[model samples]
Target: MAGLYTDQLKLGLDDVGWVFAIEQSGSIVGALLGFWLTPRVSWRPLIVGAAFLAAVANAFTANVDGFAALAALRFASGLGMMVATLVSACLLARSPNPDRAFGAGLTLNCLLNAVFVWLMAKLLAESGYAAAILSAAGLFGLILVLGLALSGDLRGDFEAPPATPESGAVRLAAARTGLAGLVLFGLAINMIWVFLERVGLSNGLQAGDLGNAFALGLLAGTAGSAIPFVVGDSGNRARMIAITTAGLVAGIALAWWATDYWTFVAAVAILASVWNMGLAYYMAMTAENDPTGRYTRAIYIAVVAAQAAGPAIAASLLEFSHIGTVFAISPLPAIFALLLVAAVAGAPRVEGSSLAR
Candidate 1:
């Protein structure tokens, strides 16, 4: 919803780079902060606070009459969004059932995107951005109440017995793999959101058209998030990374190289699908290595860092070349990194390792 109405979010970001940086900066910062915050603070405050802040801060985005105000609001909102997501993911990680755990994550990413985008579009349609943000604020208030009231058993005290490895080396290896996998997954998302959006908009595409592209990509992402569940243990996650990276890169290439609108949209769809696949695999890798979600924060750190750096890198590329050229360098390098990091994945468990919260 907020995404569909780019025109409504008034900012003096004439340079596409400025807008991309503002948009991604919030997510990156939020992720970085949230990843670390949730492990210590109770999830309740983090969730509710983030939701309220996001609603209030985003509303401010509509009313920011100057660049500095807009930037401040965005940074605050980004922190809120990341904290909320971190709390949600932490909750999901703690779920007793594996299927439900992954399902929770899937639902968060998909359902929220669907509901909020629709609500935002509708609210913006009738009342404008301010009204739309106000609606979001109301929902956040409700969540705050519910979370405050009902978090009786949200935290899992002691984790399940650790998975003891035959060798300490095995534990060390798994930790390295999980970190590497996370970095790759983060990079893939960076390429699409930061670079792709800028490309579509400044390169003669309409707002509705870009919204549609994003919508389709998100839809594909939802579908692609199930690889780990299906592939199971002993699955070649490394190969999956390679395949997904290649596909995402191809999609980006299509988006950049294609002159026609539909052609570009098709490319975006491929990216949407492949990126989701990568995320699922990465999450699975993380869980396999750190079922407790303790190391999840560190994973979050890497994820945030990659997301932040990827966009800036892409934007810098655009400065020297065309928007297309910026997107040209993505996902593949990240994928190669995954191979180097998580290559020897199909191994046994380890103690104090998976960072099981």
Candidate 2:
């Protein structure tokens, strides 16, 4: 959203980067907090409180006068949202079919994002910045209600028995690899996503066309997420990740060469879909490999940290290089992530554990 309305926010390029950084920094902090506290406390109250915090923070953000104030509010909002997000991940990680669970979650998120983006674009056209901000706040307020209705502990049904020392070591090793891969994957995706609008504009697309393309791409991401849910346990998560990574690389390449609107749209849709699908599988892999929820909780921390770094790094690169150069560099992290996934796939499974469904 900040990417789409930099002018309205009175932000320069550096300011935009800082805005994303501050918000994601807050998310990293919140994820760490959730990691520490989730096992010690009731998640219901925490989620309820966080939802209220997000609602109030975003509501106040709509009226903030300056960049600093807005940034601070966004930080608070990020913290709240991250707490909620991590808790939800913890719940989903315990499901029997974690791949499908993660895919369903991703599908819902992408669908909502697509809807909200389209709505925000329309509202901004009619009502300006305050309304758009308020609309977001309203959504957060609704989340607060949903949070209130949620019952029981955030921990899910399946709690793996305490691991043996050797098994614990193995799980930790695999989890670390998965988390590292996720961080790299996130960096690759966001590097392109953060600059997509600018890329489109540079290619002579109008603002409306770009927004529409983004909305469509998000919808395609929704479809991508749904695929795993439809197929259930396909028993080929590593293969899926590999294929999606290749598709993402191709999407980036197409985006670099695309001069026409339709070509750019196709590129964005493919990128968005494959990125979401790949991350869903990656998340499922982490959850399944480490059922204790220890490493799974930390995944959000890595993700937010990478999201904070990717654009900042890309922004720096843009100072001395062409956008195409940055796009070319973007796929390297994803390729490395795929390699890590392969390693995880080939690792020996724990006794009585199933890698293939």
Candidate 3:
């Protein structure tokens, strides 16, 4: 949508960052509020209310013109989306098998995302941006309905018996490490992902072709996220993150080198697949670090902040240097992220066990 928004509003590529940054600002605020309130309130109302808010905001988004109005609407939408998202994350974090739970959730999400991207492409082509935005609003409306139907009553869900002092200190340290890693991981992925359509267009691909590529790529992402669900908690989480990160780096490199459409499609597939796979492992690791879901709320904050920063940073790089430079530096954050998390929770340590020394 960033690409399309640029064309619709006649914005430069760097302006895309401003849009994402403004939206993410609302997410950061919502995440902070969720972090503070989850321990005090019920998740059901929060989710339902947030969904309604987002639905309304997105519905009105089609009627707005100019960057400021669009940003304001998107910011409202982001705020609602983030609050709902963090509540869901907290619930998943408290699950019996957090790894498999998060995996299943992401698998379903990516599957839906594939269809959403395709639909957005078609809607924008046939009906213009308003229809696409209205469709998003409609989707949020559906989420509001689902929240009413599916969300259980879970007050005091964040309450947990305190760990012993010795163990508590260790878990806190490890959770902080993993959260930092998550920040980097989120930054790296979104930086490239937000610009992916532009990358393809620069290489002579049509919007429809890129749309098809994204759809196929996100289907691969569904499979990638599902691997953890299939493997369950028995699989090595840190090792999985490392492998997926390596694949992501390779895909980024390949995307930079790709000249042909098929080659670009292959790169998109790999990039989408591995980053989503990596996300499951990252979230699972953070959840494993803290069962109480307190830190998990912080995960939303860290991720939202990074998601905001990634585009701004990438946009800056694009402004100051070549796209090649953006590609060159992009993988470094992911590499650093892997190193940070693996240092604390490397292989040979099973899930829910104390972080490896």
Candidate 4:
């Protein structure tokens, strides 16, 4: 949408929201679809296809002259990327260990996106939006080749666990219990994510400096997650989650209030590390209870839906709040999520679950 905003396409309000929806439609749809399936039905091919198509579609955007054409391309891009995301999620679920699975996934995603963004910035600097798109096309083409080689119709290795169909009453009760807490968690996390970059810019940080903040934060978080993978059991996962959420609350507040680069970076790193650790722990919990594969898919649906909606929900709150106020407000949701982690801990674990499964 930003690209279209600066292009001959001359996009406006729709571009900001609707166009984004269109462009990421594939990821949105594919993730939901992926959650509905089991490990044996891996969506890798769909994801692979999506990546290749996204590049092709992006490359062709240069030829588009008006809003309508741009919209079409954006919609196509959405379709492609969503499939890729869905594939990734399916893979995540199939991991024998959720925390380890998530740690690896986070690392891979961060590294790839970091490289991709660096290339994009370089391309944009040298040749503008069109060149950036072309550069992405080349990257996507490379992804397609690798995907084709490693995943020749072998994407569906995971299988859904058997369903012991519960009554509607039992299921609705479960959902009612979970809905509020999940929304709160999403809002809290996204609030931190969306505004962190802006905070850096507001503090007189140079262009692209925020990337370093994310890199450091994620690395710290990964290191923390590694500790649990080496020693902890599911019994103490809730405490870890609570501690991490508290850290996120404190980190966000400090980042909003702090002035120096060291202070801000320190806050960012703490926020990144603990928040991701919380996520890994929480995801592990979800996987534990999802032995039938059906429940696991549903959990993924909640997570993916949250991922799609969190930023928009956070942005809406920013309309009436100052930066400090907004940053402070996010803790409410983090607190709520911490409570959920505690409550969900009381739920039973289903055996033989995979993060990618």
Query: Which ten-residue region of model 4 has the weakest summed lDDT?
Result: 348-357
Candidate 2 has which clashing residue pairs, if any? none
Predicted candidate 2 versus true structure: per-residue lDDT over 1-357, tens digit per residue: 775446776788999878877887778889988888787777788787888888888778767778888789889988999998888777777778888998888888887877788788788889988788777878777777887777765543336767677666666666677678788988998888888888888888889888777766667667778877776567587788787889889898887777787888788888878877776777777877776677787878888888878988899999999988889899999899888777766878775444422
lDDT against the true structure, per candidate, is 0.62, 0.79, 0.77, 0.61
Using TM-score, give the best candidate's number.
2
Model 3, 11-34: lDDT tens digits are 776777788778878988889988
TM-score of each: 0.76, 0.88, 0.84, 0.74
User: Clash number for every model?
Assistant: 5, 0, 0, 24
Q: Which regions of candidate 4 are displaced past 4 Å?
A: 1-14, 24-26, 36-44, 126-129, 149-183, 197-235, 298-300, 307-325, 346-357
User: Residue 115 CA error for candidate 1 (Å)?
Assistant: 2.8
lDDT of 2 at 116: 85
Tens digit per residue, CA lDDT, model 1, 187-214: 7557556566666766688877787767
Candidate 3: TM-score?
A: 0.84
* Pairs of colliding residues, candidate 3: none
RMSD, model 1, all Cα superposed?
A: 4.5
Off by over 4 Å in 1: 1-10, 14-29, 59-70, 95-100, 153-169, 197-211, 226-239, 316-328, 346-357
